[model samples]
Target: AQSVTQPDIHITVSEGASLELRCNYSYGATPYLFWYVQSPGQGLQLLLKYFSGDTLVQGIKGFEAEFKRSQSSFNLRKPSVHWSDAAEYFCAVGARASGGSYIPTFGRGTSLIVHP
Candidate 1:
């Protein structure tokens, strides 16, 4: 069974500062990576996803992630974070199952705090 690990439970960054959230996955074969953000009282919004092709993939809201096979990591980054970006970020890893559907494993989640 594969699992996802988000090292940081909470991360604080000043508004307009660069932000990076760490995500590591344990899987034998190639896996899928997904980043999602959930604001207060809002549904989870997909920030980015990496299935294949590019190692560095751009996402919505000026976010991007790089998939490093050697490191078994898919880290999400934003050059300048906004105060509205404060939310709970989740890292998920999916693998193809016998039925050709993907089974996703999610990390506990990392809370982002924005400072003035």
Candidate 2:
């Protein structure tokens, strides 16, 4: 079975500060990892993903992530935080089911709080 874990439930950062949200996963094989952000009442928007190729992938909104197979981690980072960046972040792992379908399992999520 594959699972994603986000140890931090909530994180507070001062505006304009760098931010890093941690994510770890356990899967039988190489998994498709993703980072998504959700606004208060909006649907989730994918930030980035990793399937293969370069370990570091650039994403929208000045965000990027590095896929570390050794550590089973895909942590999201932002060079500078903004007030509008306050939202819920989720780490998900996608695995192929027996039916040949891609099933995504999401982490509990980490809330970002930006302080002025």
Where model 2 places Cα greater than 4 Å from the true spot, the runs are 98-100
Candidate 2: TM-score?
A: 0.96
What TM-score fits each model? Answer: 0.96, 0.96
The global Cα lDDT (0 to 1) of model 2 is 0.97
Structure candidate 1, residue pairs in collision: none
Over 10-29, each residue of candidate 2 has an lDDT whose tens digit, in order, gives 99999999999999999999
Question: How many Å off is the CA of 57 in candidate 1?
Answer: 0.4
Clashes of each: 0, 0
Off by over 4 Å in 1: none
Best candidate, lDDT: 2
Error of 1 at 18 (Å): 0.2
- lDDT tens string, model 1, 1-116? 89999999999999999999999999988899999999989988999999999899999999999999999999999999999999999999998889889988899999999999
Q: 6 in model 2: Cα distance from truth in Å?
A: 0.1
List the global CA lDDT of all models.
Answer: 0.95, 0.97
Prediction 1 global C-alpha lDDT: 0.95
